[model samples]
Target: MQKSVFLGALTVAGLAAGASAAATLDDVKARGTLNCGVTTGLAGFAAPDANGEWEGFDVAVCRAVAAAVLGDPTAVEFVPTTGKTRFTALASGEIDMLARNTTWTFTRDVDLKFEFAGINYYDGQGFIVPRALGVSSAMELDGATVCIQTGTTTELNLADFFRKNNMNYEPVPIETNAEALQQYNAGACDAYTTDASGLAASRATFENPGDHVILPEIISKEPLGPLVRHGDNQWGEIVRWTLNALIAAEEYGVTSANIEELSNGTDSPEINRMLGTEGNLGEMFGLDADWAKRAIMAEGNYGGIFAKNIGENTPIGLARGLNAQWTEGGLLYAPPFR
Candidate 1:
């Protein structure tokens, strides 16, 4: 009958959907590269150097995942996306995962049909203005023109902050961090508003970084992280635990220099299990025994990546405030690897 045929077709379509959702890992392996979505440019987070080589804290996550899956850190195609384009790119499967400085939010996670793997950076919204503007705080920018990225929580936060303060401002919508910097420097906007960490990153790129000062007001909580499409739990688990491995590595004092020795078997039972000495934890995720080891070895540990890329010694000069390890009085905590 026609009804029976329609039911069978629906069943086949459901199976196909399930199969596509499960195909990300296998596709990356077959293609030999992980397509990682990143910001167009955000210094110390994700950006290209003068030589056009991409390197930053966010880039390290992609490299670590690639190393874990393919045993090659360089096996990645970095897809640069703007605020408006990032979600579309991920939803359409243009990229395997997004490691950009994207905030995790309710609408994005539920309505937008995406899964935020984990928070890699804890941040808050803040304002940055040229010191010449004589604006010491966000409250002073009552009627200022603000350069903010569209398609971001920044826009909503900016609106809320101004309304709460009973102030008003004009929004100069920008699509990328580089554009926001350009517009702010050109005096197109009176202030550049974004996550406080981003304000530091943006200011570091200026010719005279000292000319701009980030206002001290930390307005909104921004827990930025990697995300994947909603329907794929397997893919989500792979990316999520890959990040957790990095964090856990730092917690256990497992550096890249000693990962090989630790893989041989550590005296600590937790380290042994994490390094795949006792169980087929990697195999459970359809990876090799040395997956986490390779990921940690690709970069160092979480702290190592942070220090090398965007620490206070670097041009970005970001201190480990809220981003420090949980034990160090910050919120960066990893769940038990065991």
Candidate 2:
């Protein structure tokens, strides 16, 4: 089943054709829901909880977009997509946006005709093996059977890393993270290769997580973020600035606890503009003034979202590291709201 009458033209024809076609933002509004593409199931990223509600850092992006556009966070339909299917889902209009942990690469950005709004997480490729393998370093896995996910940057990076290291290895290609975990745990592969953050998330779900160790080698950079289709500037801006608002909210000390109070008034001009107290920024985007406020109130801020999902205290146990705010010496800098 495909929802791609207009998007098919958008994909095959040029950007001008897409622009002349039905606007995705308008389509989403008329449909009464935002279709958001997410991973099949990556813990602390995009997964169903016990009650079947999707929740995670990536899921929050979708909810925020829905809240910003539709004025209701729960108005999003979470579409689970694999690495191979995510792009098609976005291009075919099966999904309005993709908030999975996808990397920003040249080919995907250019050749695939997609646009990454901005990087939400900075990551690196890594290897994980059983502790008993005694493989403390990635270089030790010369003859390892690596479980790599197909249709992801990991495949090429794994090959490149092995070729550059002059090491011989066998590939065990899998589809989703769950399949990778199954194969790696079943001894079908000697090690699993993916983003370091993924390794942590996967290991955290194992029955005995302490039995595995992630190698220290970070083979390649993985700047992961939400993406929208190319040529849909309106839809793109909605997702892009919504993300920036969450980041900016954190930097400006705007949390869910005090958003309502701060909405009444604020001393900082930037905060006032960001929270929609004194600007027509949302109107400039053809949305209500409370667009960003709804988005921020839906999820708190970027740091709060991380801490509640995959941060140091969560099962993923990830530190702020490079994902901390720019003021804190990290790369997470949002543009001025004004």
Candidate 3:
């Protein structure tokens, strides 16, 4: 009986130690600012403006989380990271969360020991060649010199695409989007390959956007979103559900303009619960009742962010194909807040 009691006490202490070690909320709150890892410079995704302020679709995710956690959207220190350095920055605790447009893959999730909070953008890899190259399709480019970013799935995808098509190409390895674009424009590379959305974002920054054509072929799945380090379930939940809150807000007809009114109280129980008008869901996540309300107000709803930043109305001119809400026949859906 004495041995059994000792073992039970040890088990309880172990569990308590594990729980204490997982308290990301406490750590972030004490830090007073969220360290967000973002792309070095992707125009519609995450980039610093002339005044050094970060803005774009991906940056909005960071701001939303900041609003949720620190009650201030602008209370974020945006750390620019390259494809090669992003994982190391997150793993080493240089950044609290990564809101870059990174793909969620098995190797990245398991091998890299990162938790993919959710898929905010469903994309695919593609090639962009200058229209003058006379390449109507990706397969038409034989013996092409491709400018591709290193440490990205694009590198392997480019190799596989060429091998499967029985084509030969030279790789001009570049480190960042800016470098790849420079090499492609300077005639050092015949084509550029990356996520289709990235291709569009890059093209939008060109002096003559119409001079480039993104090939019709989309190669690999790129479910891109925010990510946090593994073994921190609490931090993972904050990032994951923050993204879901944005998506859910859009689906439930919640907008930044109406969010303040709705927060007071809503007849829709789901909306009320989500906005913290009807439940203590925020308490469960170690946040105040107005956490999600602040998040939504930070950058508007998911749809609003898309349209204002990278949608068809914007210079990026990306149509919401697969990224549309599930209610509208796309894949964007979030679990109920309750």
The TM-scores, one per candidate, come to 0.95, 0.95, 0.94
lDDT of 2 at 205: 97
Worst 10 residues of 2 by lDDT: 13-22
Model 2 stretches with alpha carbons more than 4 Å out: 1-15, 20-22
Clashes of each: 0, 0, 0
lDDT of 3 by residue, 218-309 (tens): 98988999998887787898899999999999999999999888888978999999889897989997888999999999999999999989
Please provide, for model 1 over 55-101, each residue's C-alpha lDDT reduced to its tens digit, 9 standing for 90 to 100: 99999999999999999999999999999999999999999999999
223: Cα error in model 1, Å: 0.3
1-338 per-residue lDDT for model 2 (tens digits): 26686777667677566665449889989999999999999999999999999999999999999999999999999999998999999888899899998999999999998999999999999999999998899989999899999999999999999999899999998999999999999999999999999999999999999999999999999999999888877788889999999999999899999999999989999999988899799998889989999999898899999999999999899999999999999999999988
Whole-model alpha-carbon lDDT for candidate 3: 0.92
**Consecutive 10-residue window with the lowest summed lDDT within model 1:** 13-22
Candidate 1 residue pairs in clash (backbone atoms < 3 Å): none
